[model samples]
Target: MTTFASSLKKEIARVARKELKDELGALRKASASYRTEIAALKRQVRELQVALRQTSRRADKALHTVAPDAPAESPKRGRRAVFSAERFKAQRERLGLTQKDMAAYLGTSTLSVWKWETGQVTPRARFLPAILGLRTTGKREVLQQLARGAGGATD
Candidate 1:
């Protein structure tokens, strides 16, 4: 009787282990499938990011011009330079010009120049190029440009 009881216990244990292994086999295959799907999603995201970068470069290229009079300029940046009230004031000082002078050169009112310098308002997008254009020029060139707008010869 004792030997029969020991054999029955071993048989029950063996059956439970086989049942557990069979159940886990299906779950193991599912986990591997999920991992492969995640890897594919990650690869697609990387490809999309590369495409976005290339599109942005093409747009920037479009903004830059190649005029015969202008010559080939630095790579065209799609966005305009940031407006700094201090920078505007500094540019005027660098060229020994006043608010009225800056306004005349930019084809705006003196009050507008004062407001820009005080940070009460920003320059218009149309005026940004003219203001920034002053950065690359010297005192003589700036005077010439301003005088030309005034319809007179520069002093």
Candidate 2:
């Protein structure tokens, strides 16, 4: 009876060891595969870093070679809008744009448009083109343009 009990215990221990070895073998294979992937990613990162450095150097060289006063550059126009006072007032009323709304569209402060409407000031030359562009649009179109925020009601 003692021999039988000892032999049973030995068998159980052997089976457990075999199961643990198989599980550990699978884990070791997975770990090696992950290590290989990580190494490849590291190599790719090095290549990209080298490419970025080369690109930045080339851009710097190109910038240096460019003429300091190239025609590629243009003088920045002043912020000026030139619209008739009566026309501005009439259009704002027609398009249903309040002083605040007009400022929003014209990219000016509400006080500016208010003063412009009251004949105390005028729209800047820069804002003239945009306001003129708005001339072609109707009230509904203007509403849609203002609604160009995010996913709008019309959207």
Question: On a 0 to 1 TM-score scale, where does candidate 1 land against the true structure?
Answer: 0.46
Name the candidate that leads on lDDT.
Answer: 1
TM-score of model 2 (CA atoms): 0.42
* lDDT by candidate, in order shown: 0.74, 0.70
TM-scores of the models, in the order given: 0.46, 0.42
Reference-based lDDT, residue 63, model 1: 45
Best TM-score among the predictions, by candidate number: 1
Between which residue pairs do clashes occur in model 2?
Answer: 80-124, 80-125, 80-126, 81-123, 81-124, 81-125
Clashes of 1: 0
Backbone clash count, each prediction separately: 0, 6
| Model 1 lDDT per residue over 42-155, tens place | 999999999999999766544432222443232255644566676678788999988888778777889999988876677777787676777687999888877777611222
